[model samples]
Target: MLMYCEDPSSFCSLVLNITSATGNFIGNQLDLLYLGWVASLLYPAILVFIILPSLILVLLYISAFLLYIYMRRKKVYNVLNETLHRDPWASGRYLISLLWDAHGYIWHGYEVRGLENLPDEGPCLIIYYHGAIPIDIYYLVARTILTKGRLIHCVGDRFLEKVPGWKVILEAFHITPGTITSCVQTLSENNILSISPGGVREAQFSDHNYQLMWGNRTGFAKVAIESKSPVVPLFTENLREAFRTVSWPQRLWIALYEKLRFPIAPIYGGFPVKLRAHLGEPIYHREGETVEELAQRIRASLNSLIQRKQKLPGNILRALLARFYEPTKNE
Candidate 1:
């Protein structure tokens, strides 16, 4: 029976010859079916263990290739900026152009409204309500480059200087906040200067509700007064939605990170999201304005602009649609 079973055709012939042999033949067939079922279940496990890692490696390779292309283009710009010692404003504009071109014109998402209102040439203090993420600075930089080819001296947190390669890049961009004297000098040079009064505190506490972290942003007004630069009130539409903040508990934990002088809030918005930046009418500084009064007025102007921009139906629709597209511009 065992030998006959090994050769199934012979077993079937023998089973036809004897009815009792049919039961043994049926049992053997059932055992074979059971074995095939067991093998089918285990086959997928073997393939996953042996093949998945290789597939992941291939994906990693593709990602690396894209990153290499991005880095190489950026390196060329850096070399050009260094070799030419280009005018600061021109250099900034060139960089923005390079980034925009590389990213396939992502900056077009911005529906700029007040370019006509920006001065053709002058010293100005541009105060924009900052987004929770740092992309707001990039948008401001891009706009400045587009209009005047002038670099805006951005006052960033002191901690940014501590980052390894970031320090050198920030310095190249003429970003400095180490001292009031340096700030004053930059402003005196007729270079545009931008400040986000909310700073790190706003980034940490702004939550994802589109609320401004600014309670009373007096420092920017004071800077405007000291520097004698006219205040430009800028507003960004859908900037916060570009990078949503994490949960409140996570934000609280991040608020405790001390490597930075302030809390290191984790920014959650990035690729596949659209952002828009807009410049409002410039709020000219009053000659005899006290710092407190100027600050109040600047805040009021920014809030009003925010409310107006937010109410625009087109802006709101674009903001929602931006969630699906990757940003190509500096922001």
Candidate 2:
């Protein structure tokens, strides 16, 4: 090898070139290895964050639709036909029961306290804080049907009527208009009625502070007074964390809702967060109480329930962790 070199400097240059090539080759391989490691992590992250949640929601709705078809085929009771024989299993209560067992218990592990406050019989008014999706309220409704064999009438927002194909379902659930007349009639008929005074506005705009957006809506209180129904205050812990609406541009959404009464905000989060529903002591309307006075009392009771049970500025991670461990009330 030494005899073959015509120029010593040239030979030295060749040796240095070979060394540099070897070093570069090793560095390239190391970079490839690091990139592969990152790919492995990113794939699972995509699955967890994007794919799995969508799949879960799709499966939930599909199963519910299938169950509804099965129930309909059985002809236990016709949803539109008032003359049909009353069958509990054929009713909306049965559907809610199935949903409770499948989603509430297994996935969210939802629980309710002060269920005893719900009267065994008679007309009662339940006013609950509406969450972003109000899925917890669905769980509560399901639980009530499962335990009490009684249906809780709901006064839905006027917008629900505008949704195509929801008419039959709404009728089956006994969801009447949020009018004072409809609410009073529901209570006078000795039905346990549930109403959310904040309605769509609260669901769309309320933040972690859990502020009640009731704001001078005394219709529910007036209905209670007219029907002589005991008003029960209800709040669910960590409701804001489980499903949240887009916070930015909240003012625009609020204004649109106030004027047009449309729900236009984007909502996210379907985490398996622990949910607990608490019902405060039922407040009866006093003989001399005006509508404003009754409404204020109800609002205060609901706020008290939220303060006593929920941790302020709810954290999504903590809400998810609550699935594994118990949640403590904020001091």
Candidate 3:
């Protein structure tokens, strides 16, 4: 089956907001949860991605909104005039994950493969290619948790750790500092941890070839080895098409961002592009492998996954025009 985006109408057009609000019509499906349960999930995404003008506040607002709705409609929360209330990390993270899943299915046509490879129970290290926005990580966690019933301790960049909004969400997800200590701790505790070895560099520099800038980043492997965790290589296809990085002066842009904290390289595109995440079999600890050697093993696995699922997410106009012109040429 073929799928591609179409030009918007001259007047009205399909947009993400309209697509998000489409949930209001699915009240019946939500009703199965009852108002409290449903509110717990929907309110967080709405408040976070919509209202707070930020992300972390989403955790608290989700609870408050759900409570208010439950009390008014179902009568609940009995708590006071609350400015803020922190929730269990799991609760907030679960809500955000659910939103990503819904959005992935309804908007991006997201798909995941190879779940049988994950360990039945134990700390596992998951490494993947990074995208400009990294929403694909959310998609992965959302689906993995639902299918595998496990929460992954994802790692984030130093820059995102500073974004006040992302700071909260990242912390709630057990992603912090991107340091060896945190990574080792996550895996040592027998919890799955996910990190993108390519990190911000790849996120900013990716191109048509799906380049991964994880050069010399072997610390993740060292940590995994120290924790005796198996490494799972994963890659989500079509990230480059989802958000194309700006070319020319790319290095200069990254330099300025590092020195001045201004966002650079100016990438765009969050369209409903198709996404396929490939999860590879675990690379268990090797007795004598160095950190670099172990990292290379994971990298090779990830590259294999990327190569297998990679596609251009072709231009809609180009595909249509070529099709229309095909028969004429043959004739």
Candidate 4:
């Protein structure tokens, strides 16, 4: 023990021990600082990407549930015997109306021009370009309920039946399985029905080109002819900007969807963009018009509407900024 004072080498050894301890302490402090820095980056990312979206989704579900309960308790969803066909599931209809109204107002500020073109009464066929998610359809339906007190029965993808727990909601919304017969019947009964001739293919692969994928698909035209309902060509401005499929490897997804009848494209974006649906004057089927001819005429009419209303290669930023500004006279 006396070597501490007597032996120089022993004193050097003690100093070395102190230096080693100091180095380890500093290294540990640096490691902690590094960990803190990493955590600082990770936490916000978790909050934004994971927590916030999940919370928002949960909030929506909760809100829907509460609204449903309130409607049920108030007997607001019941169908009166006389108006059963006109306003089925009054409570559900009302709840959905509120939800879509809030969504259209807050998220997109959606509006329908030429709504006057939609008859106040009688059968009509509304054929619109299908967006990646077709959210605009809901807005149109809700707007119809609010403006005309009429329900716009929709022809939905057949795969909608495969979605678990969606059947009831689909029925409530009068979303019929996509079939020529059902469409014809809906229109024959003097109901307003909407369908997309392009359906999932156009929604998946059309990109921002505003092209119709209704190749040789004249069933809707036949429905219009058989039901004797005037076809209303509808197109929404900035519809492509609201949602889009992933661009990379899109052809592969389209191929898969074609074979399996499944929407395989990864859809993204629900930007708070401006969405306006323009309805052209209703086109009636001429006596000599073939189904193919009728379909082509409607397709061309819709394309012209698109060319007039939407810019090619739609810009998401421009659409988003449109929420704050009014449309121009030319637009």
Candidate 5:
């Protein structure tokens, strides 16, 4: 065999021929497979990302328009019948309640304890352990509306006011800052004031659900004392299930975005979760107690209530039983 193929040119030609044939076969196969893959993916990808999204947007717009029309008609009738006395806040609250109910009933699948502790009448300060998400506020609003048409003014951060449409929504809900003047004005109007003393730091730090952000929150108690309002300690379990907050790079990005006045927390949920809020017995302000003393007392009350609840076994049976139990009315 070596003698027969002694010419170097002949051997080189044989090797080149084999290599060219192998390359051509692989190239042809790849082209055929790639073409088939493209044909299979093209239509489905277009339908999913483009056409489907457009259809969803159109349907949402039409639904929103119809809802607005229905609400407007009801409002006009209420005004004409002199049933509502042209109160926009009342109308807004009614609409919000209706919307809330339609999506999901209040405490329908959740449980609320300590409702008996909430005052039946008069200006009071309701402070709760704020959750990672702000769903606790919605639960409080729903509860307040059902119990008494007493408006609950929330002391929110100045950052929320900077967001484009958020300022309007917050204002409509009578949510103000956790400032002294604002607290005094809100209480003087005979309206209940709700404050989460933990502010943004709590929301950021409480990555796990049900974990409180309040290590040192005394301003709420001071507000209650100065306003002569009783401090109502509130606790919400399972409220964190509504939405999970970003913990890492996403959290860092969100903080920066918030600084730029943008809502960076990406949250998506249908029909708000059935969050339950427990209102503890009121702690009245002493006649001449210092603000520090008042704050400490309020903190102690809240911390104790939360600790007691935490000791309970987090089992499905307990949750179901709680949901079925009716809350006792405040005396």
Candidate 6:
């Protein structure tokens, strides 16, 4: 009896310890119950509030992208068709050119030299800096036709296709969008193609500072390289004064106008101002040059040309009276 009684107390203590451990394990589950309940409440709210809105935004972005592609395709097709339509009035551009020539002569006593610098034949990529209203384009086109007898197709802004009167004007001038494909075709066919890499932003923001606004626009270099064409850099003076762009509600308004492809700028004096244009020596592309390097080279060339325009001697009043008093060939 004594031998069995000695271990009975120790055995009783072990049994009590096991009971205490089992009770604490059940108590820990009760403590976690509140946290589990909170997670269940939050999971549904997060899915409905945060995840749902993000999904809707994603869908909207996709829709907008598809719409932009469709409109761009439609515009390209229409422009190609218009290009095929021949202008029966071969002298149409000639008359228009004369008008601008007279206008430039009267206004700013405009003088555009360097017609000799342009090649007498095709496949020339006429890359120029955009002035206030691209008055340079008109001056050069008219002068080339009047002087060299070559028609130049300018690469216009994407917004031109949507302009009220500009659609007709674009078709008449054989202008197309500045897409890579268009440039390639224009150059390969040995046609004179003029492009402004800076485009509308450059035109809108110019304040007689002939700085190149072509931000990272290197595609033109690729086109020129692939076409194996000589690039002709050209620029003009006092273009901003001729027809200055006006802006109201500056930033927000301009941003909205851009989205809609609508330019909303208040225009000031047009015509009868001092005008000047200069065509630079043609820059030939070396084989295997990177587009970035070529673009920088082109930018440097245009800047040099603009700096020269500043040095030329010009008198507004005398040049104006000289042109206004002269008789037209028709007269």
In terms of TM-score, the best-performing candidate is 4
Candidate 1 colliding pairs: 89-149, 89-150, 89-151, 243-269, 274-322
lDDT of each: 0.65, 0.83, 0.71, 0.84, 0.66, 0.71
Query: Which pairs, if any, clash in model 4?
Result: 76-91, 77-91
lDDT of 2 by residue, 142-172 (tens): 7887667678888888788989998876877
Clashes of each: 5, 0, 3, 2, 0, 7
* Residue 288 local lDDT, model 5: 86
**TM-score, model 4 to reference:** 0.78
lDDT over C-alpha atoms for residue 294 of model 4: 94
Q: Across residues 37-78, which tens digit of lDDT does each residue of candidate 5 receive? A: 997989798899889999998788568655644655665356
lDDT of 2 at 226: 95
Model 3's number of clashes is 3
Better of 3 and 6 by TM-score: 3
> For this target, which candidate reaches the highest lDDT against the unseen true structure?
4
Worst 10 residues of 2 by lDDT: 75-84
Candidate 6 error regions (>4 Å): 1-89, 247-249, 311-331
| Winner by lDDT between candidate 2 and candidate 1 | 2
**What TM-score should be assigned to candidate 5?**
0.66
Residue 170 of model 3: what lDDT?
72
Model 6 C-alpha lDDT per residue in residues 1-331, reported as the tens digit of each score: 2223245469766776677798898788877887899888998999899899889977775675555444445533543355434554345565566666554544456677676777788788878877657876887787787667688889887777876787766776788886898789887988788988888777776554556789888988888898988888888755555666665556864686678765566556565665667778888888778889999999999988777654333233432443445323233
Model 2's TM-score against the true structure: 0.75
Q: lDDT of model 5 at residue 68?
A: 48
RMSD of each predicted structure: 11.7, 8.2, 19.6, 7.3, 7.7, 21.1
